[model samples]
Target: MKQRIVWILLGFMVFMSSVVMAAPAENAAPGSRIKDLLAEWRKGDVKPATGNRLPGKVGLVWQPRLDDATDMSEAERIDCINVVSPCWFRISSEDGTMSHAALSPDKDYVKKAQKKGYKVWALVSNSFDPDMTHRLLANPAGMKRAIDEIMQAVKKYDLDGINLDFENIEEEDRDALSGFISRLGTELHKENKTFSVDVTFPGGSPNWSLCYDRGAIAAAADYVMVMAYDEHPGGSKYAGSVASIGWVENGVQAMLREVPAEKLVLGMPLYSRIWKESDGVVEDVETLWMEDADRLVREKKLARVWDADAGQYYFEYQKNGQLCRVWQENARSIALKASLISKYDLAGAALWRRGFETADVWPVLAAELENSQR
Candidate 1:
């Protein structure tokens, strides 16, 4: 019971998780119940809301390799996906200059995705620098520069929208962050482009959780993607699931109190972590794709145990006399998370990044979001 309470208290998951449609209602016909949920969630959306362009199953592209040599692109699975948020832009330099290199080299990639009917939302981030974001938002010019660059990029690339992922912002700058979102959102709406912002669960670390004003954000942006993964991060002192189902559900419920279901996008994880521990103290952590996590299980022949409280499969192995454990994201776990989409009547879901999941996971997600209509 104490463990369950900690599960609910965890805030702001790290790394990235994907989100999308939820599972069919309990003991109900999937075909009918899904339609009912969709109808209810679509009651008041107007012309350019992200939900309008969704089956809302978004697969985030993380600097996918140009030639498809190493990174396996999820573009082929557009059958289950409708939009892609590429990690295309960021303000990483000390001076707050927006970098466009993330998409420059992948120009053709965006064109191809669009050609396949996928809405491409270029992701713009602050590189998670609390100090930098605080300083940048303090200067109106810096904020305008960032927003102007995003507008120029959308027009230049004919992209569908922008996914503003600003993290590590100071709690004092909460209103400033909301102001910036409102400003950018105004610009994007002028061009009829969808604008979405990424936020974490409420109440964990002050900067990550407290800095977000969910009510203001929901009013400014077309959608607010609640990142529901990283319940246990790489730097966490203890080892646990990247995102257990119970934790994610709690996060979504808490968010619904502030954000209307129609504008809330639950972000789920397509990856998992392998924790290397020495006597219960985490020493190192490795992030792996859902497929790689499966491969590691096969290679190590680790036993899979269902931790009912976690809603994930628990497995541990010894390597070089080191204790390694994982709480992997499999199809079943993802499907249960997906069920929350319908359960909550959210706008849609967005995955953290592409290429981190297995082929089997796509089918499950596609089925949950099968009724996704633009």
Candidate 2:
């Protein structure tokens, strides 16, 4: 009888510990943290007001390839921010595990952006390594270690926030992913820092795209940025718009079911894809900046045709018997996307990468932002 009673006590203790572990952190306010942040921002506690900035929130993803000598200089990077006047800048300079990650923050760049009244957030990605992401998310200890390193980096760099961009994760890590975001959000909120996440548009393949628990992530994060591009990514056999209007609309509708429109930041593509097809078979794909797309259009003297279905300009030319097609993203398409922000009452739009856009698109973006505010 004594042994049986002791066994029962151990079982009860285990159950209690499990329950404790499963509960959210004491400081976590999943559903209301973003509301609080916005309220504080409105009170002018976060940063001083600026006239050139957009009324609605806008963000730019900055992914600097360190190995490229031809990459934009610090001056150019700052100019891009000044031109766009985005409220948030997410720098993609860190990747991998807590101990093995690579962090390369350009102090001067950070200072310049901050001086321009932009809040800088450092992005931490899994480097698209599925195995590494699985290892980090599947284990509780690993998650804590990663969060510690991320928080340390956030403090070390004096960053305003962190953007969790863990991609290519296994389907099994869905709950783990939400838990990680919850814990991170709690910690960041304690410091009064923003915590945003980048999730692929829903209704895709299971492990690669649908791994995200969008509703849970929306609750935990200050902003759930839908990476709404890559509708016809490089690996795709078919050639099409990088992000068509129909695709984006469907994605937004699906996400709205899971995330509040106010918490959703529709990600817009600043680039387009050029496809080379031979005999109705796609041979190669190359990503082009807005400027490059225009130059290609001029060089080929290709006649522009409006694709009403895609809601963008389309151009096609044949070179060496290979069909070359370009789905251009100019002021019109960008303006349409910006209008969607107002149409759906979204948080705003986020541009994928900073340098890919042209100057002509900025004014259109600003105008649409003004309209959205009105």
Candidate 3:
């Protein structure tokens, strides 16, 4: 009886080995190609993308210096150390006469990107002027012209598509805005181009300022990037880090109700805001990095505090003997945000700006995303 039992156990072990060997090696699941896209989507970086027809990877800017439009090439602008390809470059008009910090992406940039096989898109934006955007919304002819110019730019630049980034318009203009987007989508579709939009988190009804009529926007866009950060209450009083994890999750979940899961791109902030309290006055310290915060603490002997609710780190530093609380993103937060993307099966996430990422973000991103596939 013992010999028989030993033989059976050996047979079972052999069978298991055979099954493991026969199965395909662990492969990337759906949307794995866009895993790094999480880095770019959250920040609205608008860099080009590569890989299959998956969601975005990272969005990098290809803008040139205001004075010298020809200073840097697309390849030069990209932080290849942490980026995935088919990078999206921001398309802006540069005066041929004067040099602008923004890249003058004409046929040359597009041609170069296409040569390098980039998934390039023209980001049609009017965020620079909220007033102009408002005017464009009210004036049908103006909107039409704006759309036409965008289309023309698309053709001239040989772009993959267009990204609508008009901000701060009156609520009454929602319908008109919807109509404009609808037309843009239709036109882009005819040319086999994509239409994307940068939308704020729609935390359901009532809090309409922060939220949008997400349903309408989703319908109009081929891809919708949910600007999930900035939840920390700003203005008048000191607020914690923008887009605390708790706040971001609620916003993303709320947005999913109206937008298709695959079409949604989650946006995150790479930089942080610190609130300084001095002399009964609260001041904002915006866009500081984690390294800077750490150095100030260790080198400058600043006091530190962690916000449990926000899941972020902060430092209370004295610059010139002025007490200021500095808040910055950390590796933990990046990992958590990436995990959330996988949990929700989101298109991906993008950081607000490149070159501002925390020192630990990239390593954490690469490790967590790779492990998730397993």
Q: What is the C-alpha lDDT of each candidate?
A: 0.74, 0.70, 0.57
The deviation in Å at residue 6 for candidate 1 is: 71
lDDT per residue as tens, model 1, 130-247: 8888777765556667777878888888878888899988898887777778777877888888888899998778888998889888887878999998899878989999888888
lDDT of 2 by residue, 1-374 (tens): 99999999999999976665555443334335433432332221222111122345654555544334223323334322322212222212222245333435665656665776667766767677677767655444455666777787767767777777778878877776777777777778767777778899887887668788888787777788898899998999999999889989998999999999877888889899989999889999899999899998888777999999998999998888899898888889988877888888887777776668787776787776666666
Clashes of each: 14, 0, 33
Deviation (Å) of 180 in candidate 3: 0.8
Q: Please, what are the lDDT tens digits per residue for candidate 3 over residues 40-152?
A: 22222222222123334433322223223222224443322222122223223221011112444566756665555455665555544444545555444444556566677
Candidate 3's TM-score reads: 0.70
Q: Rank the candidates by lDDT, best first.
A: 1, 2, 3
Could you estimate the TM-score for every candidate?
0.81, 0.78, 0.70
Better of 1 and 2 by TM-score: 1
Assess candidate 2 and give its lDDT: 0.70
Give candidate 3 regions above 4 Å deviation. Answer: 1-103, 111-117, 128-130, 203-211, 233-236, 303-306, 367-374
